[model samples]
Target: MTANKIELRSVNVTRYITPLREGGSLPALAEADDDFKYVLKFKGAGHGVKALIAELLGGEIARTLGLKVPELVFARLDEAFGRSEGDEEIQDLLKGSQGLNLALHFLSGALTFDPVVTQVDPTLASKIVWLDAYTTNIDRTVKNTNMLIWHKELWLIDHGATFYFHHAWDNWEKAAMSPFPYVKDHVLLPQAALVEEINDEMIALLPDEKLREITNLIPAEWLSWEGTNTNADAIREVYFQFLVQRRNNANNFVKQIQHARETLV
Candidate 1:
């Protein structure tokens, strides 16, 4: 769906419940509407404006790139919805405390990996690494494991890690090359079975029109666009390059998987 087509709404602060995780930066919860339920992650004062922009724009980019990310929207909370007094201890555990937190609600699903074990298919894992590489996302580590599996498919989440280059655009080239190992070793080496299919799916899913539409949903203030009137071209270029690299990697992986399967047979 296009950004213009998306109906952004403010979430009622009173509706939010206490978070499920502890000592992390944001406050997260499971929330429900009349028909739909989603995980709501609040952007606490610990994170500055950049992180907020990353979450907003990053999810849209992932969708455009054909990755299965949960539907996200910019939601404002009511004035009465500020942090509870009991949250003080949790707040103290966070690193940087800044502006009032905003809430991010994700569609509910099952977690893919446990801290002790990596249970995802290799190709799918690689594709995720590829997607993160394309976006310059730095947080999809083994520790974060922001992937979900449900109904026999994978979905990605927690993308407050992209736009790390926003502070220094020149770092783009370096960031682009860095994620290849993760994509190759962890994602492509093991489960050669689905590399070809996953690659094809990713390539087929990049929607240019959808990307352009969603770009509007990104708040202008957080991007370089605001005072300078510059568009998001720089970041878009990074995303584009990432796609190109992933396609190549996918093809190589497919060939390797085919060779291995043939040998095994």
Candidate 2:
């Protein structure tokens, strides 16, 4: 982490405007004391705090690599706001997430990235695919491409679907070394002709220090899992190690993606 690395700002949610109900977790649009509209994902959602952690770490890593990801911040949720909510589910979510939660600075008029309407650059597609492959993200499929396009450019979002291997912590090492065969179905893979080149580029860009720097940015509360009695630091270490090991063993996924691209008709 450099002295000038982006700081994750902390702000209080001033109003819960509306819920984005399309997703299972029910993230909401809220106004922060900073007076910015944000898409806030609650820590207490059914997906749990780990989802928020993934959102921050994954999205931040993309930004560091010059990928377009909206600014993320920590939103402090006050439980008092939950009392006036009519939805039982959202009320429980607000009350449970009464402290820090993950938020993305809302892009007022951004359109969801539509492949039919946009032709992406092969280099950018390959880089985005490399990002997903390295992170084990299965959510970027054609059907549910979790991306947005603002100002005629692509923006990555919704990384809760990445890092699913963490759910089985015991075999995480093996999982980290596992090949990401699903890259074949990535929405951008057809244009990802430069995936191998992108892999080499990212390998040069992400050092162990940089990877650990991103992992350490995750908030402590989000690292603690009461459901699993998981320790915050231990989980953090697991994430750090998984990323470092993933990069060190990049050949596994690099080969998988290249092979997948070769087979694509």
Candidate 3:
């Protein structure tokens, strides 16, 4: 599980295109210095930098497992950004989000994944279900698949909801090893027949060494928030520990997913 250093690209936000109002976090599609459009997640909105941390961790972890995820980048917002915005809400959000933010490369012409029309292979479906269970991601329900079909391939997105335990850090250890009951509502649960079979293989992909590498990618500023007295490295260590504990206890959730799928199908 030894990993090479992760090299996430950084981009400067050049222009704000438009806000994707569908998301509570108010993510925006904007042009970057590279002239490519990206879906920008502001650090000042919703759960603040913690959400970005979850996105970074979740997306990168998925990519490491050989899943399709849009290229993640660190988007820099200058002090003068959003100076001419007419919307007061967006202007304030921009002002608060100045400095570093997180973004995903925009997959142009991608279509929302519809479970009815598109069928995922049992193995891929099982892997996705396993990933959601491992990360404790609760956002990929039927109501919002949080997946898209780009170039006829399933691509995952919107991982800001993962690692909810950190939002209330006191019970993090308890949450880490807990079985994710929410897997019952997963959109891909019906097709995830190999949940148990893939448990060892999937867990093998995320050893403690790789987990440390993923947590190390979180920016220092994103770790310190309004109410936390903990230092950035300490917070990162907590994240690494949580992930390692979760992986060690993967069977707890693998069984849960199998039972849920059995009940569903």
Residue lDDT tens for model 1, 1-265: 3334544454443445555563254555635343344455454434455566667667766766656777664444444343453666544422222223334455455766453555566665556555655555666655566666656567777777665765555655455444333333223234445555666666655555544455555554344533444466655555455445544444543454445445542
Candidate 3 has what TM-score? 0.98
| TM-scores, each model vs. reference | 0.62, 0.96, 0.98
Worst 10 residues of 3 by lDDT: 1-10
Can you rank all candidates by TM-score, best first? Answer: 3, 2, 1
lDDT per residue (tens digit) for residues 1-265 in model 3 = 3656678999999999999997689999999999999999999898899899999999999998889999999999999999999999999999999999999999999999999999999999999999999999999999999999999999999999999998888879999988999999999999998888888888888877889999999999887766779899999999999999999999999989988877873
Tens digits of lDDT, candidate 2, 23-69:
68999999999999999999888778878877887898788777999
Candidate 1 residue 85 C-alpha distance from true site, Å? 3.1
RMSD of 3: 1.1
Model 1 off-target regions past 4 Å? 1-10, 30-38, 89-109, 115-123, 169-189, 192-204, 221-265
**Cα deviation in Å at residue 201, candidate 3?**
1.1
